[model samples]
Target chain A: MRLDLFAMALAVGLATWAFRYGPTRLNLSNMAPDSLLNRFLNATGPAAIATLFVASVLPYLEQAGGHEIPLALGTLAVLGGFAWRRSVVIATLCGAVVFGLASALV
Target chain B: MSAPADAPVTATPQPMGFRDGLTAALPIIVGYFPIAFSFGVSATRAGLTGGEAVMLSVVIYAGAAQFLALALVTSGAPLLVSAVTLIAMNLRHLLYGPALLRRAGKEASTRQAWAWAFGLTDEVFGAALGALARGKRFSEPMMFGLGLGAYAAWVSGTAVGALAGGGALAAYPALDAGLGFMLPALFLALLLSVLSRVQIPTIAVAAVATIAGTVWIDGTAGILCGMVAGALTGVLRRPHAS
Candidate 1:
């Protein structure tokens, strides 16, 4: 019940909510198909994913001294699993299994 | 992994309903539980009470930023400074809703956007885009279901982990490492699911920009750099119909 923690949570929560909530309220449905905005929006999905992918993976890679082989094989397993089954759950599970086994064995 | 310029939109997809969204959210729920658990452990270990740990998940709901907030607060940083820094780190989220709706096109309803948008976390946003790529029509109920499921898992996981205290997860070291890979694996799967040949250059640009930015400045800057770089690359290479 620290007042500072409460205030920080309230402020961060409100601001974060605003960030998540503000853009959806926009009426971007009427934009031209080839408009710059449309193009940017279309690309945002892949771009965002790629950005997150790199951001998420980098830390592990940076710290991957003893876990290098496991990490590499796990990544390949994820890719292969998705290619074979087209299921994110299956792919991620496969990756985790491979990573966990490899880590245990290595 | 296929090289088709676009994923085939097989038909007028049925608008996803609540059940469908919940089903789709299962993986995210799984992915979130361990991370949230880790966060709960970390928050408590850092001196916050179990209630406060759960409160952060319930309120802030930003995954990594909560960790950052813990460090800042525990280090006696000013409250406003900590809040501002966390918000700044998450500015990339501002693009998710608009970008999602744009891909949904004019046919999608936004009548409940104000309510559902609160659930639009990074994974939720990516999953929604993946649904669109699969030709599913957007429904507010589905978004609600998806967001709610993930949110519930996160909060519940945190509460359980907090109650269990810090040493709860330390016993399963290998499991802990594997769980750390879930978020990246999830994102990679989502990216590959919707990937197209036309977007390759944009992905490359984003990946390179993100790496460089991370190396030079910070992770947040890297994300922004990648997004802007990839978006511009996409616009530049997009074909004109007229």
Candidate 2:
């Protein structure tokens, strides 16, 4: 293993380690409902998660690759499966099947 | 909190432990396998050995960052560039902690809290939050068990992908190509699931902000911008709540 990779992981571990002191329901109880910090986190919370996932995957989308049709069809199948069933297993299986068939032909 | 009118006063139930966590983590384990497998395939394609690919999954455990690192390695970017970009990419995780801690319902001592933070990947955070919304009680043991199960799947999957890169799957071009879609599909699943539990307004705002950001900026920058826009909308929409 490269020293830098290990170091990077360790840094992430330590950075999150500091979050033990972050505000939680227990501490927030003492504050007002609309307290400045509390309000900020709440609003940021859902958005952070949504944007985070998008940002993480967008890079992969930008990578140079071909065969967009199969990828798209399979992805849509997965999303549609999820919307219908709300089950990861079913959606992934559906996507895999779509992806496999598309890949075979395309 | 008080019991309902018809309930008995003493209703202490079985405490959630490692076993419960293992069960809860099963879905995540199943979900992680294909992505980790893809990562393993990519890493080996980038000239990393099986051990190296598996090591990244074992130690780094950051999915996007590892993929980025493979890009860096393939392009021969400096090590510092890899490290800095990774830290920047994962910075959003800081937001997950406090929000998840609140949803998980109990405060931990510093030690247990740190362990929870260490295991707090995006999928795990989504699962933990979804579990809360579904009314499942949270416990430290359960959380750790969930993390461990997912961790094991990722590491082993990486190993399998890397070591088996030259095997039957690769021999079939279509099979190898199809597996590449695994991570994105998994992400889509998590996104849809999490959106289901969030308030409608928050979801709409987040969706709009993300779309605008993606069009206006690069991927990482767009994500940060979208998050800020979504947060601003959330704040404007609601004066209180987190």
Candidate 3:
């Protein structure tokens, strides 16, 4: 077990080092154009948002079943909290609380 | 050797230094610590030793897929199936690669690009992009510093949690179940922050489509279906000037 842990730790360090140094050795930055990179940059944010929506929200909605009440209530609480306080943490807490309470009550 | 001239600008100005990047990445590092701690706990519950759990995080470096693969493997799933599933789940990284390559390419060498690509995660990508959007050219060393900080937290967290035993994690049913919700909640929050009124309908439609598709397909495949749908929706929408 000790050997395995040591090996894993070594590998992690090596991987970090390689990732840190490898790009300097290869010089890829010059190969890609700034314009193309810009296009890619613009695309990534929406893509990431889409990916997150697909991966997380879609799954939650599916699990929520036919009754949209819990989801609706949760969304309202989250949005309302965010609107009132403009706080991500508060919005999340509101959603979680509403969801948990609705789950227990219903 | 110098900071890139054309890095994307952020709303708030950030100082271009290793110290600043470290400071910016601190929240994410702290956030990852406990989650990685849970992962370590879960890995040990599946009969892996501290070393094995740490190795999984180091090699895989993917959170959800790693946990899922570990669970599937310990549950007697065939090695091939587990391996394939893990690959499929992580295929999203392929998209992330090009995006990061473009942004970091200005200042980073080919070797550095490869390193950043390999080291990239949801948090790293978000933080780096957020930095870039602010017109900050993160020196390679700074990026490396941020990545390394998060990496250390993850591995150390796993090691510590594994050493602490899995029994305590199991005892807290709420925390255990809530673990699944954290990623989703974080993603939702991020999505909300990014979307404007114009994009809301597209997001809603894509999300609904994805939920509908998941009924027929299960597991990671459903996620792919939803992503495809969402991407299509995004493409169809008229481009907005940023």
Candidate 4:
């Protein structure tokens, strides 16, 4: 069940306090270094993120997409720009222009 | 000679004062505006009132998750599904917490950890952990500053986009079409940027599983399945620590 915003805030506050000075404590220093679980959890971040992005786009990709080529190329350019420039706003804007132009062509 | 190549480095990192952190967050703040503005514009067009749009941004405070929720809400998806989707999407945060907490070590106070958790978005984690991985010290205050900067940009951008672009965007069909790819493009960028910190084999497994799963399953569930499959592969591969 979802907690109301206020209740959620309160729970977080309590948890923070408990972790700070309560009998039950967390030792974050050496928290399961290089353990199996830790490694699995760690790998999941990128795995999940990548998978999620792909999944988000797959619905459109699976269909007989009308503007598939443009969308694919535009997204690729966006990723390239992001990796090269390391800025989301600029990369997307540039890619949007390409996407717009490519859509017009086909 | 850069201060003698073999000179002993300081054992502890100097505290990253607020100024440094804010400076670091500047790009992120600037980068967030357009996306948040786009979100605001879309939210209003999707039938949410301007106030509702702004409130959702403030309360949700999740980048992509907020969009997913908006889509689900507009489509009349069940509440449970929306909540589950968001949680599944954010499970990656679990991975971020350990890496960050480990870096923060004993220096992280409970108050600091709570605040950190509150503001730990993927971009923030990427920025902060990327720094830590590069040998810079992990300072909670710096992270807090970065979080605040990003948060302000997001909330304010939502307000502007909702109020300004909300009504105007209805006339621009081309704009909406272009904006449709924004999230996907963004995710692709993020995936690329984070690749350095991940193993190649893990990514391969994730990619194959995600692509295969999406063709079979639907929506966020496909991605979740891909994640599980990837993590299972990680177990088999014995996990590659960054």
Leading candidate by TM-score:
4
Worst 10 residues of 1 chain A by lDDT: A24-33
Order of candidates by DockQ, top first?
1, 2, 4, 3
Deviation from truth (RMSD, Å), model 2: 6.0
State the C-alpha lDDT per candidate.
Answer: 0.79, 0.64, 0.58, 0.66
C-alpha lDDT of residue B81 in model 4: 59
lDDT of 3 by residue, B1-242 (tens): 24368977556344356676677678667677776777787778778887788887877776655665555556565555555444533444444444554765454444455565556666777777777776776566666767777778878888887897777646555455344344444445545655666555556655665556556765444544545555555455555522
Q: Give one digit per residue, the lDDT tens place, for model 3 in A17-86.
A: 3443443454444443334443343333444455544655554555646325655666677677667754
Candidate 2 C-alpha lDDT tens digits along B123-217? 77767777767766677787788788888888888888897773537667776766655555654555565453334466567666766767786
**Candidate 2 local lDDT, residue B123:** 71
RMSD of every prediction: 7.7, 6.0, 8.0, 5.9
TM-score of 3: 0.59
Candidate closest to the true structure, highest DockQ: 1
TM-score of each: 0.66, 0.69, 0.59, 0.74
User: lDDT of model 2 at residue A33?
Assistant: 53
Ranking by lDDT: 1, 4, 2, 3
Task: Classify candidate 4 by CAPRI docking class.
Answer: acceptable
Among these predictions, the greatest lDDT belongs to: 1
Error of 1 at A41 (Å): 3.1
Write the candidate numbers in order of decreasing TM-score.
4, 2, 1, 3
Residue B203 in model 1: lDDT: 92
Per-residue error for B229 in candidate 2, Å, reads: 9.9
Model 2 segments more than 4 A misplaced: A9-66, A85-97, B1-13, B106-111, B166-168, B186-242
Clashing pairs in 2: A42-B242
Question: Which lDDT value does model 2 have at B103?
Answer: 66
The 10-residue segment of model 2 chain B with minimum total lDDT is: B191-200
